[model samples]
Target: MKKILEIIRYEYVTQVRRKGFWIGIFSIPIMIILSSGISVLAMFIGTDRTPVGYVDHSGVLASPVLPEPDGLFGESMEFIAYTDPAVARQALLDGAIQGYFVIAENYQQSGMVEYFTPDLSYDMVIGDFEDLMRHNLLQAYPETVRTRFEQGSNITVRALESTQQLNLDQWWNLVLPLVIAFLLFILIQVGGSYILQAMVTEKENRMMEILITAVTPTELMVGKTIGNLGVALTMLLVWGLCGGAVLLFLPAYALTQVSINWGVQVIAIVLFLETLIMMACLMLMAGVMATDAREAGQLTWFFGLVMSLPFIVITSVIFDPDGPMSTIMSLFPFTAFFVMPVRMTFTQVPGWQVALSIVLLAGMIALAVWLATRAMKQGMLSFSRKIKYSDLLKQRRAA
Candidate 1:
């Protein structure tokens, strides 16, 4: 136990102290901050709020100019009415106006309005203009009708089981699952690769033989796995802290819209832990089976691809969480850790299904660890050649 702890400590400290680890830990948040900064800068710096001309052919809209309105992103819009389309076109050509909207003579009946702009990319400008036109149009109606139109419909989406109404604007329900799955996918791919590389390095340097002399195979495996897991968890903690910090900047209403189902979150954590264990075991086994890093990389590529399948099919799971394909993916051990958590996020998953999945995953993890340990012991001395999968199976049968 002492030896195992020592190994764990050594591995953990060595990794945590590395510049590459710290850089990786900070990279995501830094990139997010930089990107956000660039977006804000672009929003303010390059965008000009030039006056927009409008031609209201409808005789009812007699006002020569509409009131200036503030845009969603703080840009001011000035609407100037024109008597003729030719004048508005001339103003646009002369750069006196950014764009123009022409309300047809039959606008009251046909509701046809045409907007001309040089920049199609200014979608927000068009959207804001549309909203302004909508408001102006609504003013023609009675107060009661205008109020009802402005208030829109009261849509209440209730769950069949609990009869609890869900908020349509709760964007977190759509976003959180994908975020969690993406995080898990990144951790598994990166951490598993690190474990594979570390094991290959140890084997290449003949350090495994020296280490095995001091500790049992199981102790070494457990220590190494725990150490690497600690590193992965540290990265997760850093990212979590950064995410929390970002949430602080969000509006109260936005924050309120983020509802967390603790049951689902707890299950997600469990699935992630199971995934890490399984990946670590497989990485160790891959390392044992290979004679060098090249061989290790080649062997582990298939496992990496298989692990990424969940991420590949995340869209399908998001759209139909309780679909047949999703259920199959959630129940399958290889894809369960990613798919199940995502599925749980979008819909209510049955307790029996969750339990069965957990049991199957736990069983597979135990089997993987056992196989990894057996392979390590058998192939530890056979460094001159690669270990065959059949040999490992035969050794298991003999044991």
Candidate 2:
């Protein structure tokens, strides 16, 4: 036990003292910041095209300039009037007009406006322009608003609200999957590499022989896995702090569209705890499988793909939170790390499922630690050959 503590202390101190550790830990937040800055700059500096061409047969609609729609279409547009449809179409074709609009005879009665363009984008441009024209018509005819159009008082309005109203952010299905992918990728790259390298280095130096004299390999493996997990946790905490700092210090102009939720504090805590368990299991596996730095380096790539398996599984889970596949993934020790948080965000998972996942993951970690320690005990003295997956399986069977 004392020797295990020493191994833990030694691994922690050695990693913490390395320049690479600090560099790797700090670079992720800096990259996120720089990418965010570029996105903001693109949003503000992108060129806006001036809209050209307008309605000529609009005696029914008495407006000189079409009112802009709300949101992205608000006030950043231009329109030109034309008396002849053919002339306007020609002008549009000639680039004299970027787009042309035509109102049929009795346009108000027909409720028809023809907008012509060079290609398929004509439909979108016309739809936006029609919205602009309607907005202007609304200003002139405030009586045309929905309250005036509906016959009943409270019942119709309430029915409309219930049937038609939607939470726009409900459409945000992609962010959860993206977050899952990123988290799993980090788990593979950071957590798995730490495990691989730790095993590899110890074997290469033959330090395991001396260490084994004082402590069993199980104790050494447990201590190393826990210590490296501490490193992964430290990196996560630092990145979380950096993210929080950006959120807090971001300028008002940078957050025009949405307010940052401080409740993410709770979310971050949950994520940190879950990720710690996952990394611990991965590190134990790395210790068992890696014999030297070269083999560890090669295994890192394969480990990365395996870790990403959960991320691929998450897409299906997000679409149907209660689907059979999702249920299977939620119970899976390997996949639960990616699927659980997303289920929390999109759907309310039963407390029992969460509990089951935690219990299963804990058991998996314990089993991995046992296996890793056994492998280390058998393989620690030999530095001549790489540790094969088959060898580990054979040793387990022999034991």
Candidate 3:
């Protein structure tokens, strides 16, 4: 136990001293700022500036059907009274108007209209205009008449549901889940890669042999894995600090409007720490199987992909947080780290599930650490070109 603690301390120190740790700590805020800035810039660039001319041939003048114009952010419409449909079509052909609106002789009865745009942008504009026109037409009718029209239309709402009250400061609930998933994905991938590389580096350079002579093989392996975990924790801390600072102090748009509870923040921090510990155990298991840097490199992506799969399936887990399948995933050591957080975020996670997940995770970590130690003690001693899992298993069986 003392030796293990010593190894942990050594690993933690070595990881914190590395250039990668420092680089990661500082780069995250820079990347976040740059990404946000680019998104805002794109929104501005995509906004329309051109004015559209509408030739209302059937007396449907620009009432509330036209979208409100806001300079470059919106499209303005000009209404030109046309004596005949022929004149409107001619005007559209001559580029006298961006698009021409033709209402049939009995447009009120036909309930159909045609619009022609010079380009696709105008096509969108025409579609939006049609939507607005339909909205205004229905709204103009009596409530009973509008209800009848809606019943006849058979329109069903999809994707959009209940409207949320605007509490701008509470935007964390909206962005936090996505950002948390992204952070977890990144930590697992990058931290696992560090373990693989470090293991490979020690093996290829024959440093493990020298270290094992003074300390137990388990100590060396456990130390390295702990060191990697330390790096992961440090990264999470930096990202959390950056995010928390931005949330509390920066007051940027949607973020500014929401109030954040420190208690919630503390819970998130604890959960994140638990996740990192679980990830460290898994990384140790993978590192034990890795013979060289190349093999470790190959396995890094594999483990990352496995950890990442749960983040992709978060919505499914949320819809049924305690369903049979979700229960299985939540209990599964490989998936629990990612799945548990997502489930907790989107749904009301039951106490049993949380307790069971943590208990199962703890058991898995203890078992994995034991297996990793046994594997490393057997495998790390072999000064051969290739390490075999069969040899490690044989040693463990004999022991």
Candidate 4:
């Protein structure tokens, strides 16, 4: 345990001190900031903020209620009332307004309105006028009814068998698990890649043989796996902090106010940890079996595909959360890291399945570690040869 802690400290310190590590961690937040700046610039550039003109023929808008001020964007379009269509058309021609909406005299019956614009360029402000019309149309209703109509409906989707409920207005809840799954995949890949690279580099340098003389192969493997994973976690932590800093200045404060499913989050975290261990062990084992870095890359590509299988069939998991495919994926060791967590967001996953997944992952992790140890012991002295998977399986059966 002391040796493992030392290895962890060495790995974390070595990685965090590297210039490449700081470069990669800072790139994400910088990209996010640049993209946000571009979006806001695009919102302001070539955008017509001209006041919109409307000729309301129907008397419903005669005493129109003042539409709510929409400061979400820079500024809301002013809905200028024109008593005459001829005057509104003249205004459009004279550049008094970008466009004018001609509400039909029988708008209450047909609910049809025609928009007239000279250049066919002012298409963005149409939605704002629709909101104004809706706001005025609801004036005849009671105050509560008007408020309800203005706010729209908050549809809550509840799972009958579980405590999971999602409000449509709060779409972040449904998407949060998927985001977590993606991040987990990224961290696992990063950790596994680092483990693979470290193992390959050390083997190329004949460092494995020199280290094994002082410690057992199993200890060396365990220490290396934990140490490299610490490096990956450190990278993730820095990236999260950078992203959190950027989120502070965003206008969408509601982005942070989403419902928190602590139970599912806890399960997702456990899944991530187990999967990370299993993947890191497998990567270390592959590094031991391969004769060189190229072979290790080829072998670990399969593991990456296995980790991404849940994402490949994610549509099915989302649409049919209780379906057989989701059930199978959630129970399977390779795909459960993502499938189970995302599935839980949509529907109630059976407790038995979650328990079984946990057990399977634990068993797989142990198997991976044992296999890695065996590969390390066999390949420790084989500087020119590679260990075959068949031999490992044969030895396993014999044992």
Clashes of each: 0, 0, 5, 0
The lDDT values for all models are 0.80, 0.63, 0.63, 0.82
Q: Taking the tens digit of each residue's C-alpha lDDT, what string does model 4 give over 1-399?
A: 777677667766776788987786677557756897898888777578888888888876787776766645647777789999999999999998999998999999999899998776658777787778888888878888988888889899988876778787887778878876887788888888878877887788888778877766766777888888888788778777866785687778665666778888888878889988999999998888887898888778888888888878999999999999999999888888899988888888889999999899999999998888877777766768877888788877887
**Residue 30 error for model 3, in Å?**
5.1
Better of 1 and 4 by TM-score: 1
> Candidate 4 — which residues are off by over 4 angstroms?
1-5, 29-41, 44-47, 83-96, 117-122, 239-256, 381-391, 394-399
Candidate 1 residue-wise lDDT at 213: 90
Q: What does candidate 2's lDDT look like per residue over 136-222, in tens digits? A: 555655554722432223221112222322133433333634553465447445765676677777777777777778787678777
Candidate 2 differs from the real structure by a C-alpha RMSD in angstroms, to one decimal, of 5.8
**Considering summed lDDT, which 10 consecutive residues are worst modelled in model 1?**
63-72
| Pairs with backbone N, CA or C atoms under 3 Å apart (clashes), candidate 1 | none
How does candidate 2 score on lDDT?
Answer: 0.63
Pick by TM-score: which candidate is best? 1
Question: How do all the candidates rank in terms of TM-score, highest first?
Answer: 1, 4, 2, 3
Residue pairs of candidate 2 with colliding backbone atoms: none
- Per-model TM-score on C-alpha atoms: 0.89, 0.75, 0.74, 0.86
Candidate 2 lDDT at 333 equals 66
Q: Per-residue lDDT of 91-208 in model 3, one digit per residue for the tens?
A: 7788776666666656667756667666655354565456455655676678778556644543322223322122333445546655765776677666766666666667667777
**Residue 333, model 1, lDDT:** 80
**TM-score quality measure for candidate 2:** 0.75
